[model samples]
Target: MNQTTAGVADDLDPDIRRFQREMAAAYGRYPDFDRLPLTERRRIAEEVRAPWAAGGPVMHSTETLNVGPFGVRIRIHRPDARQVLPALIYVHGGGWTLFSLDTHDRLMREYAARAGVAVVGIDYSLSPEAKFPRALDEIVSVVRWLRSEGAAHGLDPQRIAIGGDSAGGNLSVAANLALLRDGDAPLSAILVNYGAFDRESVYPSYERYDGPEYNLTTAEMAVFWANYLRGAQDFSDPLASPMRAEVAGLPPTFFAVAACDVLADENRAMADRLRAAGVPVMLREYAGATHSFLEAVSISPLADRAFAEASTWLAAQISANNDNDSQ
Candidate 1:
């Protein structure tokens, strides 16, 4: 709580401060993941870290569709009218095992309503249930399904984007790579918010922030990947860890990183790789923030502001692409 660095000092956004305190109280009992058994940790994630639905935009309706091998449940957030708006496929972050569409309901609704686009939240199969490649496969299939049937939902098929936070961000990048690798439908843009893009080696942040109540930690990350990979030693595979992928010609991207999150370095590294590959990219690092900030809409004003910034960036890209094509 460095007042000078964070600005506002004691005048911290009331909502944000309250949310942080609530989170601290919630996880106070279970401070260290290492102490808890795997089952207990999972239980805490599901039962304790559940996100509160916030007030902002209203969703017209929720439609569930089973389109993947595991009967993947996808939630669609439709806008008020039946206009052909751009659509963003959102994936929630929980280290690929905990959070789902239910935890991110408010964030998705805000994205759809504020971005003025249809949002499809993908409930991809989780680890120890479907594992790494399985979840990746489900996400890829959902994107393909959208490309085939998006027009029916008043969505412009060509204006589809894919994005998510943390593990979901990893999947967003993986799904796009799968599309390109298989010569399937290509996404127009990719949005990765504080994505955990590297798992093979722990970065500097991991060493610096491995404590509890900070939201995500380096030690917790090791546990996540242990469950996520399950001894499948292909961490360097570009699809699983997009940081290692050849970014030479991937789609345009928007990367949002939190200042204090352990995953901050890897997300920034991925952004640099994308830029090196000549891809059009917008990279933003929010100061004085932690991982998974975007989903905790009730607690983080920075999260809401971050989402709005992402929407603006996405709109600009869509508009820019549209203009380029018309020329």
Candidate 2:
């Protein structure tokens, strides 16, 4: 906390402030995002990717699966295959245009080990290159793939969950709706980590946190949304913005939020919508954390506690499958 950015305070959560300063010092400042080429931007993000505890099993397998014209890479983190286990099909978030499987590998591994459920991370195509329905279609495709072929990988397709952070969180909601529309079985649960549910960004959190202090700004968010969409018309598409979707019939959900994030209010509103729709929802907002703070799994206690709470919740949901299996 000794180092202070212009708008940030010296006494803010000492851990969060320290994490923010270190991340800025490593990756270029949040505002520099628009200046860098998208490719190089992703590269630098990879360079400073958080080093989450490598406490998982030694052996892990990752491979690319060409489904249709798109070749999506999926990495599986499983501890054992002696018994068919519940699976979590996860999507990583980078504003829909940044990071990849490698960026989220350690975080996925940590969950797989800690929760004792097999974790499957999907490496879907990015946007600006593939806009609108493309990424959403790809995520739906993987969820469909998991439902049909997961048993071969020792995963119980009948009992599965989907989870993600940020843009990936938005995709998780969209994918759940897409699957439900196709009349597929409901997902056991879904975990949304600090997701941007609304396209409008009209939430007060967006305005309040719209500064250098929080590490996410309205300017950078504009770029991400611009890159993800086909145009302004796409904002009306529920698949593009889950906050606009008919949220009824959604499975049980867990939303993890940062108190000081532009996306915070939208997530809160989403929980309200889900509850009003009779969908069970759990919302956890950690104090003093910022967007993408979970990436600080290796650094901040807030992230550690958030991760533990999320994993424990999902683990309980996955274990509930046993009662159904018995019946």
Candidate 3:
């Protein structure tokens, strides 16, 4: 509520400005996301949903895809035109425990429409029930299936891109590496949003932005890590924690970070590493925002802008890659 902070908040569009204020008033103290009771957690999530569901962009699409090990169900958002389009494989965030395609339908729809591509939202198996490697396996299977069957769905295998928020973001990166290591068809690009990359909280952003309605926190992240990693040995596995893996020769990447998220530094570090490895990387950090802002599509312009940047970057990369291939 100081002069400088207030000034920055004022810069947001009116709806986002109000949302920022309301979010602060309600949970400004940074309560641990994992500490809240199930009922309370659902309540807060619903509260966040009201605004967007009321007046937000409507994404049109065909049937949902039910393709995975154990019959995992995923939703697909397709654009209107008939010509085959590039595919954007999307994953939703819930610390690998809570969320599903339903929780993030709107966000995926918006991404598909604005980015002008087909978006496949994967409902990867959750934790405590299925555990690690299960979700990862499911996502990889679906992507491979998409590559094999994408033509039937009017999707171009050459323009395949993976994207997701938070835990989903983590999966997106892991999926990219999984495909590359296994020698599966290469993805053209990746869109990682506030991904849970590093397990350790050594990054300054973890300490600096570790508070209140800003969304992600160190304590909450620990809970996610615990649920994700049933044992300490799992952390060392490259498939489980991508930041610990070798990222060389991966596809082009687009990373978006909320300045207020505790994971910001790790994301930045990942970007630096990817760039050093000679991969084309686009990293955009939105100021005065917190984690999950993109899900708040109705209110946060930062979310909209971040999506815009990702879409633009993807278009350019895909086009350039195509141009080069035809040479």
Candidate 4:
């Protein structure tokens, strides 16, 4: 491990340490997703992450919506069917090439049931296959589709929020920006979780967690970007890197940062930029958390607390948005 990572290793949460060992054992080594064949890498990742994805079958109903070209697979997790409710367009994070609706099903269900809003989990096409703006394009299409046809799915189009974790958080913000840029109505709010916002950013956490000690390495991040972007040209595109995008018109936002994550500083910078631009932003840093800790919500108390905080905050923002519209 690097010296900076070693220094911070002792301060990591006990559960995080246990998770790293557990994950290492399952994968036979730390995952180098960029080096492995796509199918093999996905299989190992899914198997290794399976244990932490624990949750009983969700009580809320679920259904799939097929949007063409983008083939944006919309998996809606509804809290109930008694009335129309606010909804969130949830994008899952796997560096834009891993994970699916099933991987994030429980997390989405927990948020849906807890927040009393429908969660539309997006299973968009992955990168190297779809590339940078393709996924972002699908996000835009999905958000717009949600706005136009949400009522048919028991969702209140005017009360929809957008959110995602890791790369998904990047897309969530980017999609909202795209919508506003296109002169569409604004989304209710945004939920970002440990997102990778800047493809070209260099932060302290990158060095501190540059090796396998923290489960995610800067080298792996580099691979992820290369695979997700068309080429070097895409790096500076504000849609691909939201930190460089205009932020003045963003909706109220709540994003979480893992104290030990490489992306922590980048996420912080995004929050700071948003707040500086007069956008309402709430940034939460969990003391002992690591990247993708939310995936362990079933097994980690820290993860659970993070989810609860996000859930409460999301419900409030969506509720406030609804109240404002009524007024």
Q: Give candidate 1 misplaced runs (Cα > 4 Å).
A: 1-18, 29-44, 47-51, 68-70, 230-232, 319-327
**lDDT tens readout by residue for model 1, 1-327:** 100111221433445545556666666666575476756766765655555654657777668877655677888887667567778899888888777787777778887877777888988777866677888988887777777877776767778888998888999988888887897745888889889888855577766544443457666677678768746566668887788787665788899987767787888788988888888889888876766666567656787789889988776655324753111
Inter-residue clash pairs, candidate 4: none
Better of 2 and 4 by TM-score: 4
Per-residue lDDT of 243-312 in model 4, one digit per residue for the tens?
Answer: 9999888898998998888888999999999999998898889987888878766667888889889988
Better of 1 and 2 by TM-score: 2
Model 3, 170-285: lDDT tens per residue? 99999988888898755778889889887777999888766544556688788788878768788788888888889987888889987777888899999998888888888898
Rank the candidate models, highest TM-score first. 4, 2, 1, 3
Model 4 poorest 10 in a row by lDDT: 1-10
For residue 48, model 4's alpha carbon misses the true position, in angstroms, by 2.0
Quick one: best TM-score, which candidate? 4
Per residue, candidate 2 scores C-alpha lDDT tens digits across 128-230 of 9999888888878877778888888778888788899999899989998988789876688898998877878788888877766687777778888998999
Question: Could you tell me which residue pairs clash in candidate 1?
Answer: none
Clashes of each: 0, 0, 1, 0
lDDT of each: 0.74, 0.79, 0.74, 0.80
lDDT, candidate 2, at 282:
87
